[model samples]
Target: MPFQAGLGTGKLAVSKVSASEWRARSHAAEQAGDLNGALEILEEGVAAWPDDAALANSAGNAAMRSRNFDSAIQFFGTAAKLQPRLLEFSLNLAISLSRIARYRDALAVLAPFTKEGFSVARYCSVRALAERGAGNLAEAGAWFEQCLTLDPKHARALHGRARLAMQRGERDAVSRYQQALQVTAGDAELWLGQAQAMAIAGDTAEARKIAELLMQQAPQWLDGLQFLAQLRLAAGEADFTSHYTIAMQRRPQDHNIPAAQCAVLAGLDFNREAAEFARSAREKFPHLERFALLEAVYASAAGENERAQSVWNTISLKNNDERIHLARHQLRRGETDKAAILLDLVLQEDPTSISAWALISVVWRLAGDPREKWLHEQQGLVAFLPLQDAENVLPPAIAQLHRLHDTSAQPLGQSLRGGTQTAALLFDRTEPEFAALRDAIGATIQDYQKALPQSDATNPRICHPVLRYRDVPWHMAGSWSVRLSGGAGDRHASHIHPLGIVSSALYCESPPDAAADLNGDPQAGWLELGRPPPDLGIDLQPITAFPPRPGHLALFPSTLYHGTRPFTQGRRLTVAFDVRPEKEPS
Candidate 1:
């Protein structure tokens, strides 16, 4: 191994004494906590001994730690090629590929290792994830079951099943998580997963308890503190500030907590405090773009548009580039024409910019484009027919849903605070009440799909419809009931479904005051659409407000911003779900 090694930016001498010297030196650097230094040493070693799989594998590990997935992929690929018998090398390569969203590539890498064996459970679970990522949910589910059959206690497989159950709005998610924890009670991640499942299942009180216990067990777990904060916020509790404080105290170096706190305060209209928090975070992590973005958001939320623009200008001018923040501000201010121009520039730079695509839809709508054209261009932007005859059939189902909510339900996902939600995936469950309601929804969806306008390849809504004729395959379904016993109900926040096409809220119960204005707010308890998130510092108004009426369903694009207005009194209950497109038969 006597050779001169090039370290990319420098050179290092390797001794013929042994190849182990380079690895030992790299190990020493890693032990001394100089991870970057270790990476550099490994790089030099790889350069000198190009054919050594061990050196390449070590380099790949270092690159993975550095978050250089592309470099890791290259190194791991080389290692796997050189050592075909080393399953670990192939697994590492596949994992790295998956990290970069190259699911097909990852699947290819793992193809040879998918046979039955003692170590096959990991392969099965990984393949499941890859299939899920590739939008083959059916295949993903099969692989997950395969993994469970091989190793029931497999942590990743169990977590995957739990996540799938959650996505499908299944009540059994909690049990699935509990089963996982039974096998590995000390796993903090498993505990967090259970907490999340509970939160999503509408058990915020229990979720908070679990989070608190997790924090006690792992004092430095920021996610636990964040979960507690989220649960408190969703419950509309007054003392939610302490969780953020505890989180910061646990790890002040983490800028995410401060950044998120600023957004929350801004959303609450605590502009002064939000601004202060943003400034503090900016001072602490001056180099991070996240805080600067937060500063701009705070300025915008405070109605200081000029200040917000100036902040964006400072950032863009310093970096000498066009920034999405500026375009977002334009959209927030209803300057669609300006936003269009800016977003075009953004698209040119990165055509796959989700935010840009999303904003373009809003801009087109605001600019008075036809619904068909705008919806088609936006993709994922469409409305379904409102359900009919719901007054007769819904009451019984509503009663059953409410009973579940009252007796055993938890609060809705932290996003829909102040509401208790049921856990059963309505369509999948066998309850007669749910089945009847599901039938109505399925019929309505079928009618909506049949009425959809014919289109060429250009019309995404028509071309990529999710409607299934023989069956209504909802990606996820659940019910949430918002009952404000003493005070105002908390509104659902503006957000998008990350894994859905058509999102809906079917009104099952509305308080007497739901249709009435509370303190001059006519939109109270109404489903609102098109408002940007408050934390983005843009104070855009809702474009549409669908009045809440029992037996009516408000269906809209999953990509659009939608939420409810907090009502002053009474209970509001609704069933919501995200639908995924069924794959075309081959």
Candidate 2:
């Protein structure tokens, strides 16, 4: 209680007075709703008193509210720099950068946040979006998954993933959208996203129901109206065409609904409307092969198979891009061998033609020759990817390659109650036999690398998946196992592996979500690995088709033909994969 006028106490008294004045001005400005004015006052106060982290942060808040993102960044940076221990400013900087589309920068900013990792759902959600827009899709996907793992109910992440899934044709996206609704039942945007996903999945019925709910919940949502129109047109509802035509009345650039409408009416004996819609779409974006494909479908349904085929032929020669679509139509029209020849020709010209490989995959699946196992792998590996995704769909043949020895059960490989099936298998998981496999092949690969000692990226064969086999390139990425499955009665297609690759399948546990489960869920479908057609001079005949057994394993060249039959019942199970020697470095 000594009235000793201490220097420190006097300095504190003066500091308090200045702080009180700043707070008063800020509080008044905030109460009056002049967030900008409050922010200006805080900036001045913090500038005068550089150690005042609170004042600096207050300015940042006001800057953020005013959408002055750059200023917010400056204020947050100053605060963070002045008080190096403060977590708030750094995190806020990451948030603001994310908002302004500096996602990669934001990610870099957030490296510090991973220290003891804060579970910021919105932070991860925004970061994932930024990464996606930045074209780092793989990283974005992993981030989106991380966001969901932290907060399964993270609405934005769920919505983004749903959109991604739809784009990748992962029919399960519709279910993810529904699950997102559980977390945000009141969120109209999530509802709208679900509607969009359903429509994309070709389910117009449920989309309409959700659209109706969205209209009720979010009357002003433009996406809801768009989805409603798409659903209506797809369902072939009365005057749906008129509805789309009229919607074009208010907002004519609605490519989404009209494109969908064109798709719906294309094949069901309705060419006139399909033509009209496709014409409008073509006017908007001329190079849509899907529309051309629709036009061909319309012509074919109208008993103009020649006209339809001509349309495909005309478009096919327009550019290399459309050839695959043309080939797809050829197969749909029962010209399977012709489609195969087209793809084969393309592959012969360019061994790594993505479109040719993709078409080859499609043909192999339909061909049902176990020899085509290599085709499926190539489809997965070499397709012209708008994005690498789940649709590198494993053909059923990749799992069980039945060389046309017999349409009967033959134990694959040596345990083969004879070589009645020379079929090779492919898988994704490891097995005990794979242990000797992992040891023997693993050692061989290492020794091979040691002898060669790769010095260049031109090594065609590189190990891709496993941790131990780190140096293998794409062509040489065999030697690993994968889990594959088929039901009681499934056969592979015909195909060949690439020049130096050896493919194999080792039976593992059956797909847990097999045929029985297929009927149990709307999203669940039977898992059958079918083969694609071969492109790269791979006239590899059909591999042996053996009925699936849990322990069965087969090893053979990439040139074998393979595919799977649609499962009627029981779960066909196995591990299926490929192995190839390292390409001699060129």
Candidate 3:
């Protein structure tokens, strides 16, 4: 072929080459370990052969390999358009769309095939995934069932069904996972899912053993290592990072082991050690920006402000997450204005960011910005609803929760200290007591939503324009029970739920001391709202405090910081949940 000179050296004269030649050259570049170069060649080929479905599909595959889902979606869509009759092209387009969380679009692409009675297991499985991602759980389950009906041993469909069972708190989740594993025994994710199901079903010991075996088999498996660390931490083992240490010893050159170790340490609240370890890791792997960021965050948590700031100064903030951490650091140093600037920039880009909103509330409070009052101090924002039939509900609920608190220590990265939180989602459990409590809480949430102020765009809560409380879609993002053993300095740290629109604490049990008059020395076990974390060096006090009552729920904006006062004696049990809006205000 006669080639014309391209605009740049090393660039392919794609116009002069056939599609097959372009694919061949691209494959050669990929074999030479130049993925970017291969992708460039494929893109040029795509431009030259705009009408070629095969060439477009090849380019889409290249983009998918690069983890550029948007580019893959574009190319896959082009291919699907050019070859409307080809099932593979449409399937690829749908898969690419699902990868980027464009679930509705994915479903739209698959709709025609569904109408045409396409009975392939893969098609049904893909539709199930899209439906699941779109929060249509029942539809997802039906699709998965259809897939299983067509092909009983389809591994992907079985896996999807098992996952859905887990999410729904079904007792059969373990058996479903087992069924999936029977077909694909070598899948690490299936094994992990089975282990998780076991743990949720109150088989923590067995779960730990499975995780331990997995770690021994695959030293560099980050998920297995993290799961093992959580299991160890829950068991009150002092040396929870032992598996990580062993992994490092076995795979000395694996940078991911050290990185995961750093994250595990920080997540488990070993801030000082995490800071020191991350600094050392950065020294060894100076090219990893993640290590630098980890060092800065852990250093800040450890109260090593100077070291944190020094590390932050060296880092180029690449994302809003990094900027959020920088803003937090500034807030801790009492540099509210600087923190405000960073937070404003973040909110400008992602107005739905709960972290940014939470931090900005603090900034406004410190800088005397009136928006603080508009955000947190609005009337009816916080509600205390006394559950009906509290006397009947309390005993069984508390007893059921006590049985679920199998661990000796609190969970990693949670606000609770000197307490043990339940391992499984409370609402999803098969216990009848939990079901009753969930129903009661659901009714309380409806009442609370009804009482909320009219929709205001500036308000975080009730910002959605929908006026009917029942019409606005929402779901419980998380539900966990906490049992605090009093007299051991047991309390919750002041914090906000970054993923929730509305947060709640339902007091299932309260200590005798907690019920005492507030005139006493310490307002024992009282829930405190709007109190900034002590480490943040903010001089603010709790805007309000509530006495814990059995079967009573306190609902408030997730952006407001909340915690509890330490009591001298007895047990305090509570169920907490975060309510996530299905759609946020535009």
Candidate 4:
């Protein structure tokens, strides 16, 4: 065969080749920076040597590198099946399964190896991930601990345990990440984890220091830059994008820096600044479409709709995310029909998209589509229940929440405006008030579930089989407390919980004005359900409004848009949580 210019060596002749020769050829292609070519060679080799476990494993590796987890799963499954005794092949198969969120399948693949007493850290680590993804956090923790016991310096196990600890609001998370960094000092993720732990613990200064150090170490690292920006924004700093600017200066050719800067600005709700920065970025990187998209989205958010529409017209929509953003732009422009069409297309592609469901619900309501009620206003979909021991729970919970709201400003990407939300998960805290409140909230959730309408197969909310499960129907996915100082313009933005089955707000304390009549003066501080965000230009009124009462809980479908009206004075404190269906064991 003729020699190839890019290939390190001449092409192989069209004849029978050994598995080792095929692997070498694939390695040469990989070394030439042609990952697709390497993957093609490995797939051909797997076909030629179908029973060769090593060839199949090599093909799996190539597919995994290309981010084709589905193909990797098939290849790795074949390898594992061909060589059942080889732990490496089984572990690789488990990894691919985990990548695609087939956690139970991954667990099944690794279960036999555990009985074989392999005692390998990598095996334990992979098992830990599968268990975590399967929603068996305790078992995941045990596996991570076992991995660390076998190899004290195992970075993945250490990182995983630290993350689990953080989720549970344990202070040990900071130390666990620090311990991992002791041996793996150059690990960026460990540093980021440690910084996040510190920030959650109300040590923003220390978190900022770690993030700044990360920026210095890896200038083009977007996560590090975003964390730094978040820390600054939370500190109420006007120059939140300072470090991002420095990062761009440090890495001149890195186009991602400016794009990240725009994202950071927008994510923190600095809409006008995001639009301006994205506009400048678009000019600087004309070939990059992301900047143009950012400019359009943020411009719309900032009420510069004409500029947003102009930018929207220039760019080509690439994916569901872009299509959703364009739909939002259309909604803002009062082109409700166009917006509905786009949202319908998105829903057609991804029926499980919470954002698409939420947006389309708004569109349907505006257009008086009967399907809107079928989707969202189903009987008992929204419930308000009063807590049993309101008097005893309110005071201490309010005080504890006040202490947790130490930051001057709101956290990044949250809907809270003119308020501070607790960084740590509220229910995970050890405070007696929070503990009691959690128990009460759990009881209230049961009551709310009991009041729900009979399960309907076609109903989006009721269609999930997990909701009807016997042993464990639901679990609190996340919980937090938000304390809004009832100053002017202090209110939550209309938003939906994307990853939740049900969402709630349990008031601990509320301003005197909270109970004011909607007809009197601006629905002051009341929970308003089914209102689209004002920026979306949807003039439709809220379907319902619930006045804030201490110990009262409002539970609604997470797909429904909900927020609050601004109050004149005093404080409004509440604990909010998202509920998700418990994963059934395989």
Q: How does each model score on lDDT?
A: 0.68, 0.53, 0.82, 0.82
Shift of residue 93 alpha carbon in model 2, Å: 0.7
Better candidate number, 2 or 4, judged by lDDT:
4
lDDT string, candidate 1, 1-586, tens digits: 2122333445434544245777887787878787778878788778888889988998899889989899899899999999987888988898899998899888888777776423588778888888777655567778988999988888888878877766555679799889877887788877787887877666767878888888666555656766676677666577665667676777778877787677566655666677678877888888887677777866766767777777776574232133565666776676778878886676676543445655766676666666425444343235534676576678888777776666433332335554555553555544577768877887776665555554345544322233221133443433344433214455687766645666788877776654455555766677788776665545667767787777877666555777777777667777877666554323
Best by TM-score: 4
User: Better model by TM-score, 3 or 4?
Assistant: 4
114 Cα displacement, candidate 1 (Å): 5.1
TM-score of 2: 0.39
Report the C-alpha lDDT of model 2 over 47-149, residue by residue, as the tens digit: 6777777777777888898888999888887877777666667778777887787777877766666643447666677667777655455666777888899
Poorest stretch of ten by lDDT in candidate 3: 461-470
Compared with the true structure, what per-residue lDDT tens digits does model 3 show for residues 1-586? Answer: 1121233567655578899988987887778777777778888889999999999999999889888898899999999999987888899999999998999899999988895434788888999999988867778898999999999999999999998888766779999999999999999888888988888787888888899889989999999998888788877788888788799889977888988887777765678888877877788788888889998998998888999999998999989999999998999888988998898898778766778888888888777887777777767778888986677776898887877775334776788777888764677666788778877788778888877777556745333212222246777767888888777888898888887788899988888854452335357888999888766778788888988787789988887888898887778889999887666433
TM-score of each: 0.67, 0.39, 0.84, 0.86
Better of 2 and 3 by lDDT: 3
For model 2, state the Cα shift of residue 206 in Å.
Answer: 0.7
Q: How far does residue 563 in candidate 4 sit from its true spot (Å)? A: 0.8
Off by over 4 Å in 3: 1-55, 82-87, 115-118, 386-409, 423-451, 454-473, 516-522, 568-571, 584-586
lDDT of 2 at 552: 38
> In model 2, where do residues sit more than 4 Å from their true spots?
1-24, 118-130, 144-171, 232-586
